[model samples]
Target: MKILIPLDGSAGSLHAVDYVASHRQLFGETPVILLLNVQWKVATGNVKLFINQDTINDYYREQGMLALQPARDVLDAAALPYQYHVSVGTPSDAIAQYACEQGVDQIVMCRQGQGGLQTFLLGSVVTKVLHLAECPVLLVK
Candidate 1:
C-alpha cells in the first residue's frame, strides 16, 4: 500500500507521521511511504522580476527541506523507508495533486484542535484535502 502524509511542520501535522510510523505492522510488509511538504508560492510575478529564478528556487528548496526535517527525522529514527518531495503551490491542492499523481492508497493527516470560528475563517488544509483527495482520508486526532 502506498501512503501519503502531508506535513506542514506543525506538531499536529507530525501526529499523522507518528500515527503511520507507530502502526507499521498494520500496513503489511514494506508499505511505501511518501512524505510531502508544500511550500506556498512565494515568488510571484513582481518578486520574480527582482529575484533570479535560481535564487527563488533555492529559497523554496530551503524552506521545504526545513518543513520536512522533523518528519524525516522521525522516520529515519524508526528505520522506516520512505521518499519525500517538495512542491510549490497551495498546500491542499498540492497534496491532492501529488496523491493523485502517485496513486496513493491512503492519505493520512491531522486536524488542528482549533475552535469553530478560527477553523471556519482559515479553512483548514486537512478539510480541503479530505474533500479533494480521491482515496480514503485518515484523520489522526
Candidate 2:
C-alpha cells in the first residue's frame, strides 16, 4: 500500500502516523509510507522582491522539514522505511496533488490540523482533500 500522511508538526497530525505504525499488518507486504508537509507560501508579492527565490525555497524546505520531523521520528521508532517531501502551496491542494503525482493508493491524515478558528471559519483541509483526492482517505481523528 502506498500510504501518504500529511503532517503539520501538530499533535493531532501525529495521531495518523501512530495509527499507521501500529497497524502496518493491515496494509500487507509492508506498506510504502510517504510523509509530506505543505508550507504556506510566505514570500508573496512584496516579500518575494525583498527575498530571492532561492532563499524562499530554502525557508519552505527548512520549515517543512521541521513540521515533518515528529512524524519521521514516529515512523523511525517503528523501523518503518519511508520517503518524504516538502511542498509550498495550499495544504489541501498540495496534498491532493502530491498524492496524484506519487500515484499513492491511500491518504491517511488527521481530521483536523493546527487550525482552530481558521478551520471553523474557512472549512477544513480534510474536507477539501476528500473532495479533491481521487484515492481513498482514512482519517485518524
Candidate 3:
C-alpha cells in the first residue's frame, strides 16, 4: 500500500506521523510511505521579478525541509522507510495533487485536534483534504 502523510512541523501534523510509524503493521506489510511538505507561494507579483525562479525554488525547498524534518525524525526514530517531497502551493491542494500524482492508496493526516466552535470557525487542512482526495483519508489526532 502507498500511504501519503503531509507534515507541516506542527504538533498536530506530527501526530499523524507518529500514528503511522507506530501502527504501520496494521497495513499488513511494509507499506510505501511518502512524506510531503507544502510551502505557500511567498514571492508574488513584483517579488518574483527581483528573485529568480531558482532562488524562489531554493527558498521553498529550505522552508519545506524545515517543516518536514521533525516528521522525518519521527519516522527515522521508529525505523520507518519513506520518501519525501517538497512543493510550493496551497497545502490542501498540493497534498491532494501529490497523492493523485503518486497514485497513493491512502492519505493519513492530522486533525488539528480541534472541535466544535473552534473547528467550525477555523477551517483546517484535514477537512479540505477529506473533501478533495479521491483516495481514502485517515485522520490522526
Candidate 4:
C-alpha cells in the first residue's frame, strides 16, 4: 500500500509519524511512504514585487526541508524506504493533488499543525483534505 503523510514539523504532525512507526507492521511488507511538506503561498502585492520569485521559492524550499527533517529521521531510523515531496501552495490542495497524482491508497496526517491562530483563521487543512481527496484520509490527533 502507498501511504501519503503531510507533515508541518509540528508535534501533532510528528504524532502521526510516530503512529505509523509504532504500527509499521500493519502496513505490510515494504509499503511505500510519501512525505510531503507544503509551503504557504507568499503574500501578494508590493511586498512580492520587491522579492524575486526565486528568492521566495528558495525560502519556501528551505522551510519545507526543515519541516521534513524529523519525519525523515523517523523513517531513516526504522530503515524504511520512502519518498519525500515539497510544494508551494495551500497545504490541503497540494496534499490532495499529490495523492491523486501518485494514486496513493491513503493519506495520513495530523488533525492540526503549527500555528493555532492560522489554523483557526484558515480552517483545518485536514478538513479541506478530507473533502478534496479521492482516496481515504486518516487523521491522527
Model 2: how far is 117 from its true place, Å? 2.6
lDDT of 3 by residue, 111-137 (tens): 774345845775777888999999999
lDDT of candidate 2 over 59-132, digit per residue (tens): 89999999999989889999999999999899999999999999999999999799889788868999999999
**lDDT tens per residue, model 1, 58-123:** 988898899889999999999999999999998889999999999999998887733368468768
Off by over 4 Å in 4: none
Residues 76-105 of candidate 4 have per-residue lDDT tens digits of: 998888899889898989999999999999
Which candidate would rank higher by TM-score, 1 or 3?
1
Using TM-score as the measure, name the better of candidate 3 and candidate 4.
4
lDDT of each: 0.88, 0.93, 0.87, 0.89
Q: What is the Cα-based lDDT of residue 35 in candidate 4? A: 95
lDDT for model 2, please. 0.93
Please report, as a residue range, the 10-residue window in candidate 1 with the lowest summed lDDT: 113-122
- TM-score of every model versus the real structure: 0.91, 0.96, 0.89, 0.94
User: Which pairs clash in model 4?
Assistant: none
Ranking by TM-score: 2, 4, 1, 3
